[model samples]
Target chain A: MGTIVSILVLVLFLTAILTGGYNKKFLQRVQGSNMWDWLTTVDHKKIGIMYLGAGGFFFLIGGLEALLIRVQLFYPNNDFIVGDTFNQLLTMHGTTMIFFVAMPLLIGFMNVAVPLQIGARDVAFPFLNALSFWLFLGGGIMLNLGWLFGGAADAGWTSYVPIASNQFSPGPGVDYYVLGLQISGIGTLIGGINFLVTIINMRAPGMTFLRLPLFTWTTFVTSALILFAFPPLTVGLLLIMFDRIFGSHFFDAAMGGNSLIWQHLFWIFGHPEVYIVILPAFGIISEVISTFSKKRLFGYNSMVFATILIGFLGFMVWAHHMFTVGMGPVANAIFAVATMSIAVPTGIKIFNWLFTMWGGRLQFTTAMKFAVGFIPTFVMGGVTGVMLASPPADYQYHDSYFVVAHFHYVLIGGTVFGVLAGVYYWWPRMFGHKLNERLGNVHFWLFFIGFHLTFLIQHWLGLYGMPRRVFTYQAADGLTWINQVSTVGAVMMGVATLVFLYNVVYSRKSATAASAERDPWDGRTLEWAIPCPTPEYNFAQLPKVRGLDAWWMEKMAGNKELEPAEPLQPIHMPSSSYRPILMSLGFFVSGLGFIFRTIEVGVLGLVMVFLLMFTRSFEQDHGYHIEVDQIKEAEKGA
Target chain B: MKANAEQTKNQTAVQTSQESAWKHVTSFAVMIVLTAIAFAAVATNLVPSHLLVPLLLTLAAVQVVVQLYTFMHLNQKGSGFPVAFMASGIFIGVISAVALMILV
Candidate 1:
């Protein structure tokens, strides 16, 4: 199956090379840009938008894989997908969600909003930021490349050893998964460092740690989590890569190495990984809710503390996922309690949101609706989470439909919903035009209902002893009706997504040019201080931040504008270059070589990749500066 | 001009003196102790293999800490967050590896 996909991919590549229209045009345009320009493009807004567009594209692909899973599971004993095929769908769905959807979306939001919130022009490491994005794109492409070869990875997204062992599952599919994640994980680590440095060193003068916007604060902590969380994963993947490629015994049970090490390594990174995905969403919701409510976020310090506490606790509870694997009662009990304790900080965040909205004149825009909707949906998932935290109870629920329902509720309802809300909240900021409200409402309702219908009943199915990851179940199991209903919900989600796409495309063409100007929503944050379609260099001079909701503070003080921190100066901006893309391509080629070491073509490709990297490093170009005169002129026009 | 040149020469000499003194004393003392311990363990065989692994690991851990503080400058200014992040990562990695070792 994987081989067939590879053949198809080869065909597509050949076709793309032959047709040479859009793809060729894009390549030409990319080439026309100076090699150094892309390398140093220090514009935060551009990087942020690149993250959004790239992340959004991956989200669609992941979502489609999810829909395929739902379709296959819609009927009892259905053979719509075979066992290997089903495995691929499940694997791709999980991998895509973690590496593609969740990571990219969070990074996208961080890239887009972090600089604006902190009153900075760009991230601390602009070149590294660009590099991270390209590496991420390369990783994403490699992960999906399974479809073109023969099939996608058949091992679960976790790709537990013994199952993932070459003897049991002999293919390059798992290699793609490992290498894809390894490359993307590097991007994530780099991004985390960039944000950390940005927040620490580049905040506007007087915007101290305590004065930071919640979104920026969360970005800080999330970046910290990423810094701490990703190394174990890198170590684990390297070990696994060794085990597969070089015949190491890291996870070989027969060779006195333990398979459980992979689980520990994966989840050590994996558990904090959940917060790495959700905290940013939580940050987004905090901003959206407060802005729409017209209130200072209640218990702001507590909210900050809660974010920190959750991040700290995220590392402690990785073993809770291993309860059913039997690490003895003491270990299980410890992990169980630690896992449940996370709810306290998470609960504090929920109440803070509710209280912020208690008496304010609440505007129910699509973003707000999703924010409000997140409360109950996330609560349901959270409750199931507590239930699963009990070690003995988990014995029955582990690897069942209940586990699936629980996570989908949390991930989809919490993270995906938060991302959608962020998209609606920031749409005007990002693209200079609003997403059509009516269509947005339609998208939300359908998605909300569909999400509930699809996963809600699965809890009962699990209770009735339905195992997960099974391609089919007998009709006698009494899951047929619920499964059928779930299929309907899946279709509804599909319809909603289509409507969303339509809205995006339609609004782009229809919205008037002037409507693209900044602050269409009377926004409170620093991002709205700049003009719509923000400049490449965000501010001519940095704004002196006086208080929370800095822009709003300016308005209330009757200043009607921010005070500039300095005289207009020549803005030093990084130039964009193709080195990042080329560097990532090197890794992609090397990965192919590593996966198929016997092939001469693969070996040659590896050599070429190394040569490319060496050449890229040697090719140096310094960035140019945008003079003060140009900035002043642009400001005058605004 | 002669005085300034003399001062520059003195500064370089002093810097190199400090570096060499620290490097020689630390390496000789540490390497001797580590070699002695390794030989002692092999010769005596007092500790069992299971215990041996842990003991060696502990020694390695101590060595790592010392190296980080002295060589890596982890104890210096501006090293707080990076140290914290690296330590937490290593701690989590150890815990997870141990858990999986026992469980799976």
Candidate 2:
């Protein structure tokens, strides 16, 4: 009964907030100070901005956690932080950076860019897209919410079992991990399905499969990967949840269960997840490289095939992570070869980028600089990856700083660099004004030097037998100087990030300083055809994709814009509804209930979920139609 | 927007839906028979337990194909991608399960 009352209060409060949280009514605030409009918006651009904001916020938090770890290890035998707090920091840093930072940042670009590039009005399921974002936010909150309750998960982000069992950990920390990932994983899975459908069905009339943008193509493959990859994660989390909340013995070795089961389940999803994040980065690099090179992407057909091949190979190499677990010589050998084979497609991409820029009039803008810089850094990481793939050599590098350096080299070098490129490349499209290019250059160079400085030396430290995930080292270990240098480099990276943030703020103040949003970069895609600060209705008339580089072809032909494929008509769009927020709140509340062991709260959450579904089913939502006159006015203003 | 083309499109859509319904009905009947045979083989104890496991496994695989092609409409146009993903997912799952059982 108490749970019921609190849930009711929460519902009423959320309703009030969604309907009347602003100074004006929700409808009025659509043109007023509309915080509520954002909460309930099904607009892809707004949701994409929200994703960028939330992901950026989480990136900062994760970065802070990294700084704390560095501070603890800056000196030998330093007493900066104790073991427990250090474990929490390490776990949160890994969990937050992978789930909260990289995934959402890429998805944000997908939301904003995919529909525009394909010449679609919105995603196939606009309402579900909104729900995916909200659920992600809810899950991120639940994972961090443990900081206030008792503790955050300290079993590492993988949450390997036996150690992660309820009896051993004995707290709500891992519980939050299990529940938080499950909730957010569902959102990711749905988001992937949405993208798959949108790309397949919503392409412009002439946008053939062979003619799709590389970003759209990567988005398509990544969605397929997410569809297949997230299941193993979902099942793994379910086993863990049962073990923690319901007294299952799935991972309890004493009960005839195997702990290796958890590892197998995790790496199945975990290995592909690396591709899930990196493939989009590959797509971003392809776009930036070709655009700045003032040429078409070299080896386009091979690039597409290589992307699909990589996704398939991603599933084949999960066992490589477990070579140390006595998986026998044959299994280890098979996985080792499989892992090394990934370099084939990756090498193809590298050479393609190089060839794309070989003879073109290259523009060394900040975005292109990052794209060019990513090549060497990412190749170095790939070299280390092959080195680590050998089980014989991995025996030496396992649990060492070498492994850490390899991934950071890949992740920071590949994913982070690609995100920065995309942000600089698309900032004018996302926001009304361009980011100050001078500051972006400073930001890029500082971040680049600092990144190499921090992780590159860690390779030597690992060879020196310095272990990873350790809080501190003994002074006699002779590891002080290298560690200090690494930390110093971290500080430089942090300072570079601050410069970027200052650029954002300083740029915002001078919003009208220039009107460069309209094809500022002389872009090649359909997205560049529109005026920057794109109108809500993205395309007045569907575009006919005559061929690849559709807009570029038109511009070259001296037709200011491609001929409209059809006359204007009233556009039917999905209604902007608040149920997505309410539905995610249901999952969030249930997560809280599970953590607290309150059955009633969990039940109430399910009830809210079902109740919303029931209401949505019976409701008649024909969707508001934007009149042809309003569209004419919008086009006139543009 | 030719009149004859529109009529052909609508006619094919109707025929496709009707064909799907029949396929589903036939597949459902076959699934029931396969399930009953498997259960009867176990219940009647006519076959040895050793042989029964393989028989049931083969029967189950066939039934799955039937369900996928007929009930799930995997044979339909535009289902090529989903089928491919599901097949690859199953292949990966089987490899992981087999390796875990044998090696680990």
Candidate 3:
């Protein structure tokens, strides 16, 4: 079956390329059928959409893995997917959802929104932006490929040392995990740098840092967190790779190597990774709340400061995760204190959102609903987080369903809600048409209720002394009903996801130009200043940001459009290239080679990558320009 | 001597360039001397073993600043953003390193 499917896929791919090559009519007939154009395009908007598409695909795979886990746990002592299979499912579910799904989804929104918000034509490095997206996707694909080759990674997402060491669990599973994350982590690191440069240097004239939109501010902070956080993960992965593959004993206790080093290194990256995902979500909620409430974000400066503080505090609190590993009481206390202190900035942000919505016209759009729902839901997670932060209390809660409940509330209720809200909020801006609001509300209500119902009971189950990562439990344990309820909620969430997918298709079929208004939602950011289907050149002339909420300020002054920061001139756009995808493919192949321990294959792949890089170093891509006349004509059409 | 405004501007520019050149050479000389002292200290055991590491580290840190300011032009105008990012990165790096040293 696998061989047949692979052959069919190859055939379909060949057909796609061959038809386009020989038949010009077929290419012109179907819009978006120019697959080559999309393959090589360096446009940030297109790359953003591709990120969403790929992220959504992985999300479904992860969600399916989740549903299977829930099913197995639905009944006590169920023979359904026992032992290693269950472990693989759970491991892949966590790893996929966190690294592939959540990160990419948030990065998708950032790519779609940040450049526009800053009033820049494109990201500082368009080619790198494209490269980042492809590398992430490539890494994601390689991660999933583990299932096809014997088994998937089953050592849990944390991949704790000694257990994950080849001597204990000898297989290519953990090797895939190491190489895949290393590749994707590099992508994320470079993406963060790209954003930092773009945000710092690419803002329009007169648009100072203080005047940046709340979302842009969050992206900036999140990028900084990514920069500081990912290197440790990379180093950890490299060490483990060496241990597993190259006969080194980085975590081998028998060889005088300490296992505790792995935990410290992992959490050092892992803890800030929590912030890296959530900060962007916080940014989304801020944007949605303010936009739908028809108010400027209250305590904007405080919100910015709070974001930075949270990011700073995030790095200091990683050891909290290792309290159970016994780093002594003093170390635990320090980590615990640092962890709980994060609540102060988080609390400030929560209150700031509430104040922004207070005494304003609160429009309950689908986006607004998700944003409002996020507040209480995220606060619940935050409260549980504080509860778990106490080192003494954590001794009871560690590796329990209570821990699972807390993170799901934060990850699903916070990050997922924020991603959903962003999708709804920016759908029109992104695709030039709005998602059906009625279906959107249905999706939101189901997801929100299903989310709480799913995890809320698990907190009690944890309290009832149910440990996490177990395949099955005895009926005498008396956890059957709660597990069943959680499964029901998981099923509901799965159905809600289907509804969202349906909404996407339903909206696309009915999309029309009239529905694609320039200022949909009467948005306040510089993004809404451009056309709904944002122009190829995002701004014909850069929008001069005079104050906070630049668009709203202009609207209040009775202007139809932004005050242009520059005279009408040709706009230089980075030309598309095939190198990013090819480079990613080279790396992907090399990762597989390393996992399988094939020296010739690995060398071949590395040589391909180096050749590409070598050529790129000398290659000059000055990019093409859109002349003023063409810009004027496009503007007239809009 | 009555000089034109352009000539006066040129003279000032030349003078500043010469001063910059002098500063670079002086910093380079100081770096060489520092390196020599470090070598002598390590070779001759002039400093106690307990304090030698700190001395070498201090010298290394000062040399880095000199290199950045003099050679990398970090002291020039329009370098505020780069300096700020570098400082933040260093701050985070040092804190993590120190924390690891203490705890690990």
Instruction: Give native contacts recovered, as a fraction, per prediction.
Output: 0.82, 0.73, 0.36
* Arranged by DockQ, best first: 2, 1, 3
Better of 1 and 2 by TM-score: 2
* Model 2 RMSD vs true structure: 2.8
Best by lDDT: 3
RMSD per prediction, one decimal?
Answer: 4.4, 2.8, 3.6
List each candidate's DockQ score.
0.53, 0.67, 0.49
By summed lDDT, the worst window of 10 consecutive residues in model 1 chain A runs over: A1-10
Q: Mind giving the per-residue lDDT tens digits that candidate 1 earns over A529-632?
A: 89777888887789999888888888788876789898778998777765566566656665665665434444544565577567767877577889988987
TM-score of 3: 0.94
Error of 1 at A88 (Å): 1.1
lDDT of all predictions: 0.83, 0.89, 0.90
Q: Between candidates 1 and 2, which one is better according to lDDT?
A: 2
The whole-model C-alpha lDDT of candidate 1 against the native structure comes to 0.83
Model 2 ranges off by over 4 Å: A1-33, B1-25, B44-51
Taking the tens digit of each residue's C-alpha lDDT, what string does model 2 give over A1-638? 33454466568756765676554655575635477688888988888899889999999999999999998999998998868789889988999999989999999999989999999999999999999999899899889977877799988888888878888788788988888888888889999999999998999898998988899899999998898889989999999988888888888888888888889989989999999889998999999999999999999999999999999899999988888888888988999999999999999999999999999999988899899999999999999999989999998998899999999999999999999999999899988778888999999999999999899999999999899889988899889999999998898899999999999998888778365567888888899998767989899888989988888989999978766777899988887888898888888888777777786787777788889989999999988989999989988877
Give one digit per residue, the lDDT tens place, for model 3 in A1-638. Answer: 33343334335545765897899887766535578789888898999899899999999999999999999999999999899889899999999999999999999999999999999999999999988998898888888888987578889999999888998778778887888898899899999999999999999998999999988998999998899889889989999998988899878988988787787788889999999999999999999999999999999999999999999899889998888886899989988898999999999999999999999899999999999999999999999999999999899999999999999999998999999999999988998898999999899999988988899999999998899999998999999999999999999999999999999999999998689888789899999999767888999999888999999999999999999989999999899887898888778767876787765556666786798899999999799999999999998888
- How many clashing residue pairs appear in each of the predictions shown? 25, 0, 0
Every model: iRMSD = 2.5, 1.5, 1.6
